[model samples]
Target chain A: MAETIEMDDRTIAIGKNHKLFDVERIRADFPILHQRIHGKPLAYLDNAATSQKPKVVIDAISHYYQAQNANIHRGVYYLSEVATQAYEQARECVRSFLNAASTEEIIFTRGATEGINLVAHSYGRRFIQQGDEVIITTMDHHSNIVPWQILCEEKGAQLRVVPIDDHGELMMDEYASLLSAKTKLVAFGHISNSLGTINPIEKIIQMAHQVGAVVVVDGAQAAPHTPIDVQALDVDFYAFSGHKVFGPTGIGALYGKEKWLDAMPPYQGGGDMIKSVTLEKTIYNDLPYKFEAGTPHISGGIAMAKALDYVGQIGYPQIEAYENDLLNCATEALQKVDGLRIVGTAQHKASVVSFVLESVHPHDVGTILDREGIAIRTGHHCTQPVMDRFHIPATSRASFAFYNTKEEIDRLVEALHKVVRMFQ
Target chain B: MDTDLRDLYQEIILDHNKNPKNFHKLDPASHSAEGYNPLCGDKINVYLQVEDGKIVDIGFEGSGCAISKASASVMTTIVKNKTVEEVKALFEKFKGLVTGKVEPDMLELGKLAVFAGVRDYPSRAKCATLSWHTVMAALNSKEEQAIVSTE
Candidate 1:
């Protein structure tokens, strides 16, 4: 039976999944995971930082550059026309992938960082006045926090923070208390990059909407692991990076509600973002194009669309189910390691497992793991505030994907035991 | 079991890391500076009591990995009673050792030579010398914080 999502204003129909999602077949699609490192097989568990690309996504990008490399929008010949079609098609793909209301609501950005910066500047400049309150959670990445800090500094607005509990879960009571009429903006992450906390965004959006505050959700960490419907969430703005979702780097999308996009000014002024230019006054382009300036990352966009298709083909339910199994496998395996204190054990967590070993530093653990060809992310993870809240230097983070296996988790545990032995 | 691991974490280094030498703050110190490695959030507060050009007593307080904590501990033991210029020279030699720039005689380094293995692991080089940089920051009267990043 087909699935249908009921939105605030409309309902969208979804097709049924047909293919048997085999993990072995999926592993073979990524060419990078087949290699060896330090005389051992590579187990790339750094998916939180970025994901390995499938061959089809790679081929699609290469095919674009080899055959259809031309500037888009302003076209004269066949190649440009083809390029423009592909670019626009990518926009449509991203719109549907995010389940946005329309393609006109999607704007190409440099990544999630640029997306947040766009709203912080554009929306903050016009709507957020002096003494207005902007609330963000303690678990947000630096990308989500810094832009708002800059915006608040510029606008004389007070930036408030929602704290998190020991389990890395946001204090929802505190969040509810933080809401007020003076709260002009509320920026938070759907999934914490450091803690892997899957925030209650549907409720967060509803609460922010009650306060008349525009909500900007950092979907960078969530976009890869979970299926998102912007209309269903009714979020004012959503931002995510393509690279994290198995797409090429330097390309991302910012999905804004049409009303907010209409009111907000253009982020950057350059070619392709204007309707017409004059010596005195220039007319801006319509929604989406108004924010996208300069010659965009054409190949990145096309390949990102392919990546989205790759995920859509397999379906998010399968991906989430597989990843949850892997996460559980990793969590259970890590518990056997002596004196291993997991940093983020949120009740509602994603595939990321961050922990600190007793008397062993994360950096040292990371180095030792690298020797065993286990690539884990070890550092503050750009959520330095989260590190401070935990009273830690850093934590070793092993984020998983659907293609990752339980065997890899075994290798990680074995390597960590070696780390403990070495320190001893 | 590997030679690299052996060299990186010698018995002396491990001893210092577990039971660090001069791991307390030198109260009534003449000079002090804070060191931070933003990469790992490692922090060290270097303290020294200098009389004339020679440092009489030195100590540090902070949390870091075995390499950094051990290096800071080892540094306090070696740099005490050494002149500022001598300490600066030692810093240059130690920096060179970790970076794989100059392979000085291990005996010449004495207790500091244990860090020579850090040369191979480029990522851990900063951990080996974050405290040394802080001492420089304190001795030279440079910036307020000696931020070392192994980027």
Candidate 2:
């Protein structure tokens, strides 16, 4: 059940500094970071939206298209054999990446949005009956919110929103009060993309299970930052995006518990998803392939494996240690900026820092920062309810990746000073 | 100063953004409409006091970026005392100027030419046109609380 993992010099090398992580080498792997923007070196802090791909992942994609370009699963020729092996191997890669029980539980979709939609349409149509309750959080992305709304309307179910406190932490006491025997499903984000607040997902999952409600996690923001173990969490379904995890776009994975996968009907019906199709009736394929219909994103699937492996090589023990320091560094620096107020002050947070400056609109701040070659997201971040909760139109958010350095944080602060002076 | 920055945030634009002209509601406004850009959540409400088809007074009440605020401020200053037809014509010319289809005529447009630089930045083009569109919607009074989107 286990393969030998070789610990090479690359894995064992330890650096000396406030940051023991090798950020320089990590930054070198990403090609896009080499260029200059507006005559200034780029400080890419928009990690939450999407991460820049490393050269290895890019190369893997190109290699697949160039060397092994063939339809997988049914082909008998050499190229097809290689393609099938590559594709199936990637499935195993995903299984190992998430520590999922089996490859049958891993289904590839376009992105997290598609993954969640598949669950809502297929599972919600079956298990969620009339008068059933579906609970979600107020801080969820519109992608997570809208699908459930459509499902609830279709199923004649009620959608309850769990509120968040002033510090952007989910109101756990309020959440406990909301749950009851009527709640058939509970969907929540593992981390708030806008606020970067790490939620108590395990505790939430345990509570949901006690009431017989299946938990679906929106792990789009957490996949890149934290290590995921589906077996340990025992979450019914976990969805994540490829583009956010240093992988190619148009590809992502949804990990569903095998029992739930078997219980839920196929989301889409087409070729390669049928065991038998007569003139009279059709029998759907088994487990994962039933959900994944027709020609999938073959190259993207393989590239996602490469991206996961890239991060795995760095290891979470080292990555988390580095990110915590980076978060602290950025937070302290941002707090010192005049008229600046950090929005989410949760006790536990990731590398995202959201803030607003008095009398300065986020658009103006974004424009000024862009001139300085600093890329930060400026808007409601597709979390409109969260914006309403804070009573601000939008915020300037800077999200960090492993490649980000203290030097870049310094550049952001200097650029922010220019913004304040410009507004003054 | 960066040349592009100066072009984008001209002194006149900044001045208008800070203290926008005619930035208030008309109590008994004949025509009014709200404009919203969902992309950045920018909202602008244009209020017009038209007397016998002539825009006797015009004002706006809302919040947006400096470009949008300045564009609305400049619009009110130029279109006052103009007829409905003339205001519509001026809108067409202003749109053409900012989109780089027409050259700036400072003698005619006054400070509105400051927005001509918006053509270089396509995303900012919507910012330049949001308030103008709101006024057009207000003139053709379909609803009192009418809102149009710059999608």
Candidate 3:
């Protein structure tokens, strides 16, 4: 067992200066961080794309494959029973992680993309009707936007988009104005991947509920950084990917209120999701399995539970505090550089620092930074609507995790300084 | 992170990106076309001044990555003073080079061959091809079509 560090209310109130997170010790937990990329130590700043998994999560996957590799819920053998128990345990773990009411409310998905699609197809397709509107935000990932767009098109529903301001915060007034009797669903991301702005999801959900619209929160970005309490938030549906949260790539979870899930149609047709199949018709299984069709990523699901445990052990308050400090340090350092412009300065944000050097292309900045072994994502970041809103083609994004340190932020700043000088 | 800067950002490519040739809109041009890569938000407008069957003047104006800007600069340099057929062939050759269909020979490509490094990085191939694709669209355009293709 790893040693647990305690943080009292005073330490938490004082901000992230507490020594609960030793950068070197945290770095030791992630084996991939030790390597050199181009002769320089790898400074991974691309946590928004995906996070590096800890040894515990990795070992969980290996151990599952070694000891209990079997098909779940079908066979009556001991190994099968063990595998099924582990998988269901994972579901329960996810339920607790998201603060869902029951394990039946959680469904395993391929990733956040599939999770959104499942809700769009299963719930949106069934409840949404012609002339109805499904409101989404411009700051949403294409995963959240495209699925709803396809669903709206198929169902003859109108797709309404909530716009964002210059600072990349969603215009709450516009969202409220867009809501009406015709609005059937209001889908939004809990955190903006490109901008790193944490949306006011609780307020958004409450407003949508007031208008009798179901709320679907894309928790892909939020789940990795903050503690998610779905019950407290009162969201209708919440989706997140395990890979983003330092788990395996093939697994994710979708949390729905049991009432909504039970009322929705099955997402996909398969053997495990069936209760009884006849020549005339087939009866579908209950809540979660109705949406989880295929032989799930059994090992991935199990490992995801381990990843969540790792995050829980660290404590979200401490992690968020540390990450916020890194973000502030990075923002200040980059701002001191000549011709550097940091994008997305929202009042509330996570650890993403997206910036662009005047006259230096983001690709050039990214390439030059790579020489220093500083990994950053430089592109539109799949939020083209946000890019369009900014009137810029792309920006270099450096996202942080709890494991990141001020030393890494310094390295990134130094690399940015070098890149800006080279361009000048 | 050190995944071969030479493969993605060659020195010549960087130079061209910093100091792009024909980096202006050709006013009073016979043909013009805009190309957009939605994946990275790279947009470019290729302006061609075609006098008779030859491209007498070529220019471009847009904002994008180093690969895109360099590719556009090199594209204008290669296509200028060449016949329409020759320009088309050069486009095909450049496309083939970036897509790894053909190994770029510096002797054959002159300054434009520096983009051969882009072949190793598949995601940026579209960045290198944006200019060529835009030029092709410009050449093929009639008065009826204004926008060609936005990938």
Candidate 4:
């Protein structure tokens, strides 16, 4: 049964005290957070850009390199078998993480950027036709926007964008109206990186399905914060990066339904993605192997599994509850600053808080905050179009994670007040 | 309560940031160019008024960090009433000072030499140099379009 939530300040305040995990213990697991920056304790609030790895994840990568370093899937040797087993186990772990229907549906790529490019080049080239419409949202990251723009340009198709309101929420009504007979595909982000607005992807998928359009979800931001069930959402394609989830970089997963995977052409051609090859013609391998052409990042894949296991052991439900509390604390504390305006204040948001001061540039704020040992992301954040939509050059963002605390937010607020006083 | 990098954030940089110089649009400028640092999203537009090979007036206006804005403020002060050749020589001296290729003589660079400490931060070197690069670009190039970013 769905849990009914009370929508009042007191109930929300009560919810802050009920986290399932121990925040102090969780913070201890991350070694980087304990360091001193510029003589002050490092208050890392750049979780949206990338998360610091825990000891478990660090040891897992080191252990693999030291003990089991071999190419996967191609050797009769003992070490090769061990490596292959670990790689496939990682795939299964990711399958469970996303609640995917099968391991065959998951194809590992470099990251979400590469995953989107693969779909745009392979699936879009094969299925989408000229004069067709591909709908995306204003809140999309550059990775989601540029690849589709390239595909649409190549196929002579038109790209349509669904606008968002001042609150940084997608206009679902506008999105629904854009769906028509000519709409071939609909791609959007599950959670916006810049705004932290969680899109109603299930409803979006159902609406696109009514118009016979395929839906692709950019889950780079959502995967770190929420429980993702690809099957329940019924999204045709979903992509996320490992680095953002406390895993090693250069590894990510793309989940496409078996039917769609079977229908799409191979993304790249090489030894692994083929069943047999002659000079004249090449027969592509089945499902995922067809997409994963080259020898993959073996160490990265195994390390990602360890990262997923780390998150699993902590319990995502617990992590989410704790992070929401941090978000509330940060929002309230930051609001108290004079001349400060929170940029994205959607009703439903993740752990990110993007804001701007009345007269201060974000770069200036970032530089001053750095002296206080407060690490936050500042600038356009690779979402220039979103910046354009907001009519600001950039914003200073402080994104939270489960390991963060209210005390750290207190430090941030204190530092921000000093910065404002110094500037104004 | 204190950080080692506090020396980099000296009072002069903050004062210059609060009261920036040459911070107005110069219409009918003989030369105007914009520069951007994509990494930090710091932008600057340098405008020059040249008459008879001497810079009569120099103005700049844009948004960026304290370092970039302060550097621009100091740049406008030094480049005024100077010839093109003198400005080019000053650019080289300033570049060398900020990159740590040479120890800055504060007597020569005036308030601009305060930014010599920024060379320690490799990532922020571009932020410090953004406006100077725009000045150089506007002085050298014939193009009327704004240069987006130095980075």
Per-residue lDDT of A251 in model 1: 95
Q: Residue by residue across B16-53, what tens digits does model 4's lDDT show?
A: 88898889978889998989888877778888988999
User: Which segments of model 2 are wrong by more than 4 Å?
Assistant: A1-20
Query: What's the TM-score of every candidate structure?
Result: 0.95, 0.96, 0.92, 0.94
Which scores greater on TM-score, model 1 or model 3?
1
lDDT of each prediction vs. the true structure? 0.90, 0.91, 0.87, 0.87
What is residue A269's positional error in candidate 1, in angstroms?
A: 0.9
The TM-score leader among the candidates is: 2
Tens digit per residue, CA lDDT, model 3, B6-65: 566667777888899999988889999998887677888888889899999999999998
lDDT of 2 at B49: 88
Q: Which is the leading candidate under lDDT?
A: 2
Q: Over the full model, what C-alpha lDDT does candidate 4 score relative to the true structure?
A: 0.87
Pairs with steric clashes in candidate 2: none
The best-first sequence of candidates by TM-score reads: 2, 1, 4, 3
Tens-digit lDDT track for model 1 on A133-167? 99999999999999999989998999999999999
Which 10 consecutive residues of model 1 chain B have the lowest summed lDDT? Answer: B142-151
Whole-structure CA lDDT of model 3 = 0.87
What tens-digit string does per-residue lDDT give for candidate 3 at A146-223?
A: 999899899999999999988989999998899999988999999999999999988999999998999998999998
**All candidates: DockQ:** 0.80, 0.66, 0.54, 0.57
How many pairs collide in each candidate, listed in order?
0, 0, 0, 2
List pairs with backbone clashes in candidate 3.
none
Chain A TM-score of each candidate structure, as shown = 0.95, 0.96, 0.96, 0.95
lDDT, residue B28, candidate 3: 86
RMSD of each: 5.2, 3.9, 3.6, 3.7
